[model samples]
Target: MSLAQGRSYLAIPGPSVVPDAVLRAMHRASPNIYEGELVEMTAGIIPDLRAVARTQHHVAIYMGNGHAAWEAALSNVISAGDHVLVPSTGRFCVGWGEMATGLGAEVELMEFGTKTPMDADAIETRLRADKEHRIKAVLAVHVDTSTSIKNNIAEVRAALDGAGHPALLMVDCIASLGCDRFEMDAWGVDIMVTASQKGLMVTPGLGFVFFNDRADAVRAKMTRVSRYWNWTPRANPEKLFEYFGGTAPTHMLYGLRAALDMIHAEGLEAVWARHETLARAYWAACEAWGQGGPLTLNVADRAHRSHAVTALRLGAPHGTGLRRWTEHQAGMTLGIGLGMSEEGDPNGDGFFRIGHMGHVNAHMVLGTIATMQAGFDALGLPYGAGALDAATKVISGKA
Candidate 1:
């Protein structure tokens, strides 16, 4: 059988569309691992990487996924039996808290469910109760891809300060790094962890952990952080080998370099504005579609929605069917609905998500919206017409 001739769209929450430049950069033989352009290029990544996080601190690169970065961040700052506060807005937050629990830390989870942002006042109350300051750190995800909720790290910092809590602020920026604006230093975040797959516009394999002086203090005082997960040598590596703590992910480095160049060339402000514009367009389209039925956005407020991903509920079991139809028929892959179902509900019975992240532009956004609208029509779902037009107008600033 013959396949479709046109391009196949990958609209998942992560492992997003990689740029041609990044792919070309990664297509090369292994460079000299010891001391050469690779080493020089690797050293230069720190400054650019710091620039991406909007920080002037140390960063540790790891040859693993976001999970590895999670372990590295936790292990470096919080030791066994320590206490940490995690504000759960979505699936990734819960997962990070669970990692802390597994690492022998007592975790206090302040869950806000999947559709809303975590209340800073509630977090303040929780921190204020810890008068002894037993909480060693606070784990917060900047953007939870599973539920498309974007929590406020800066507000969380303000809450911590209001309560006078002396805990490190750790952020999971895996899905928000390049797609959303995350100012680590401005947000008063101590440690920000991320991976290469999502907003960075690269394939999976590399993870990064950005740390400030506050986190360095914790690292110096913390006891028994694993060697593999240790950030001490990785951050302040005396030798090139210590940069990765072992063999480096060469091809991924190439891709990352290309992605960084793209980000810098376009300028961070432009990149952020583009993402905001596209996200608003997506929400506008969703609002139009939900006019006739129970198809509503997961986040009640637009401010809480992630710029990279949009989670929705159709109030029908046909959501999964719609997703499949969109992918197989329209060749547009949508993200699976995760962490949006209740205990009694079947697996994502009424939810679906659209990932409009890295390397996506106006045309790509329009294409995705058109394909989804097609699915809605094919499935006989209740939706108003001109949803795409409204979205296009929003993006183009015509309405």
Candidate 2:
């Protein structure tokens, strides 16, 4: 008999679980777009967004996804023939580099593969070699959702300083902003791009680009910028329409306001700690299971792994089979092994991912782990004992 009859969990990396509060906030009739509570509420949202990003800089809201923010940020400071360095750790960084390339910028990619974090030393070496500082900016991803690798932004910043390079440090924090700890201003990030879907506990629609004065100065020197993708007016809009370059995303603003409130109420530091603990719990469970089985984590080192998502390798058909079993029988869904294609497994059928970001608690994480263990048993997959025990110990702070 099928047991997947209740509220099924979507444990993918992005478009994470939206909070009930955010949903309720979005369940209202559309408000006045011109002037009213919506406008006033949106004014308050800017500061709160700054607080979440730990920045005292400017933020522009776009009515698009993370890709929109990526383009928007690039449109401001990057002109035709500009050179940009991309230190790619996974698929997302490469995508960002591609976006820059499409915008008529010269892109140099420094691939760090998929299993490990970006090497700060290598980035420093390259920047030092650029004697004329032809590279206008260094695009980096704080956390790659596909590989679940978290790079050290501070170390990257230090590399720039070590090389005495004046290149702007642009970061993609779409998957890390609220789930993983990010300090934009402190990390010396000139620009940061993020979406509302993942860590903010909101649905996909709104995108944000946070920038400091240094980045704005570079934007000022740009010869031409597309009006639609420009961030200046959106950051300091006189009218409501200018906030989004057109009509606002009304319901998304409300939901985002509520999500921001929830975030502040819980406290950012505590939120980060919660994610860290939950991720450790997941790792503990996976390590226990890997003792006797093919199940293993993609990133071996805990320091380099993202606290928001965990990628796993279970070998070929088993990965696909387990994901299907959990969704069909246990009412739980897992994330696919995105950008993890291998020789025989072109579709990445030998991999899966577990998202423990936003709105996830100890019970949710523990339950997912337990259900995965059950899936292993039902599929006749050999696994070690004490997985649940190991996970529980982590959540209980006894590990």
Candidate 3:
């Protein structure tokens, strides 16, 4: 009846499967918090983390999740009545705009629905219409995990430039950091926020915000910024305690260091390549499966879908049914179709996502697809045959 045992794979977008080395690194007893190895390690890892982000800008470490990083980024750059533009592709960016509203900022929301990517032409149109340039910043999501849609950060920057807007470009790379090909500096990203749990192969509890000189100037102009959330000291602290605001997250630091090392060892370019290859294989399988059923990828264009995650939909209750069968019967977990409940999306219950971000290999992907095919068979669901063969060809370099 049930066989959920052994090391079950967590195929959700964030909080990906942590590596054994990272776990062992965090398994040690609490280290010295005042000084010595902890302090030294913190100093060393910050630059390495910056390397992963493709940024040489000021990096601030926060003892919070992606939401905390969002708050911190807002507190530093926004005043009480500052206007901010949010081109939302999914629920999270709109939520970020809400956080800005809570912070007393006027939010100009441009919703693109849950199944589409952010439109740069639409964004440019909005920016061009703002004659007063009241918008102080633009919050964008690089890869919205909920929809598995990837928005181009470079196009956003271009839109702002085309309109001669000086608003800070803040990007939420929470689900795209190490997995997607994001060049913060090259792409003209001013403030980039991310978490350690997704592609960094580390456990949660750390959020990072990287800011450039332009964003730094904006923060300096802000008349009100909470001391607790200020980025000034944390980015360039004279003492180790200032870097974290108190006794450090000792074990988390160890785990982060180990994860960063793994990223570097694999080479960032190759890491991106691996994720792309695996994503293609998953797409191959999904396209085959969707041929004979109501299944369809939320983002129809493969170009817009995130290589780190893929969202799909079927008829009512099938998504949940397949997810349940995979979890209990095949010992695998999938991401629920998030943000699919808004108006006009009556098939909300038919959505699910597969996360193929960090710590994922070809075998793991093949096995997951194999298990999914089995679930389709067991459920008597119609699916085009040769799904695994298609996946295997792609992974084996034949496709």
Candidate 4:
């Protein structure tokens, strides 16, 4: 008696649900790559991107994913033998450090584990220890999707200032860009990276690197940077081809234009509030379920949690069992517990993530919660009562 016959929901963190408007915008025939509407539309996109990041700085568009943005950002300011400090909160931050290491930079990671946010005080201490100031940059992730932990970027900036360190404040906003509140200019971020998916409500393929004058100055001092990854031409292209180093990602640009229009129409602040409220609804349900069951949120503190995603631990087979039940019985998919492996449950079968990011609304979030409750009952997994009531109250603004 399977009931999974319908349009399914993808509840993963990245590569989030694409808006129909974006799809319609991208569905047209490939336009002239050389000029015309594509070029004009792209010109408009740059300013809107700046608005989304709350930055008046320069941005380089790339025809790639978040990983490409990571590599592209590191390529410009980091050269071989340059020292970069990474305050790793979870998998993505460590992964970014590894990318820097691959580029021949000396990488140092300050591990903060998975459940908690990066410690600003510890970061300041590390910066103070770098007396010679060999560290050229500090790679920070605004939010690690895997752990569902949001680090304070402004505090990281304050740490550098407190230590009088000259290291560049480079941040990865791939997971938090539109969903969380970020002010790149206000936070004094030298460089920031994000992708078109997730909070942007566009399909994956476009990556962006936003840089201020300070970071561009570092690029100027670099002995050599790969021509393809260089930001100068991409940021201030003389022609259309130079905008992407070659052929532009035609459809993605259109999709991005539509997505950016959507963001601005709703207002960035309002979008952030929407994600925050939906996230709270999901959290309320999880908290209720955890009261009498094995279910628990990975990040214990509400202030440290990411508005885009919520990681949960149901313990061993139950986590895997619940995920399977939801997708098979109901037309919904849940995110796997990424980079959350531990003793006993080596494969991270004890965890799952709920993505409450871009293009998501109250009904969608509430429906996911109700479906999960059904999954628990169907799988005979013990859960506390009033889960729906708690979630609904939050959504209804009565909690």
Best by lDDT: 2
Ranking by lDDT: 2, 4, 3, 1
lDDT of each candidate versus the true structure: 0.89, 0.94, 0.90, 0.93
Name the lDDT of candidate 3. 0.90
Q: List the residue pairs that clash in candidate 4.
A: none
Cα lDDT for residue 10, model 2?
87
**Per-residue lDDT of model 2, residues 47-70, tens digit only:** 999999999999999999999899
Model 1 is weakest, by summed lDDT over 10 consecutive residues, at 1-10
Candidate 3 has which clashing residue pairs, if any?
none
Clashes of each: 0, 0, 0, 0
Tell me the lDDT of model 1 at 12. Answer: 85
Q: Candidate 4: what lDDT?
A: 0.93
Per-candidate alpha-carbon RMSD to the true structure: 1.4, 0.8, 1.3, 0.8
lDDT of 3 at 42: 93
Question: All candidates' TM-scores?
Answer: 0.97, 0.99, 0.98, 0.99
Per-residue lDDT of candidate 4, residues 67-135 (tens digit): 999999999999889999999888899999999999999999999999899999999999999899999
- Candidate 3 residue-pair clash tally: 0
Q: Please provide, for model 3 over 1-78, each residue's C-alpha lDDT reduced to its tens digit, 9 standing for 90 to 100.
A: 677788798888878999999999999989878778998999999899889889889999999999999999999999
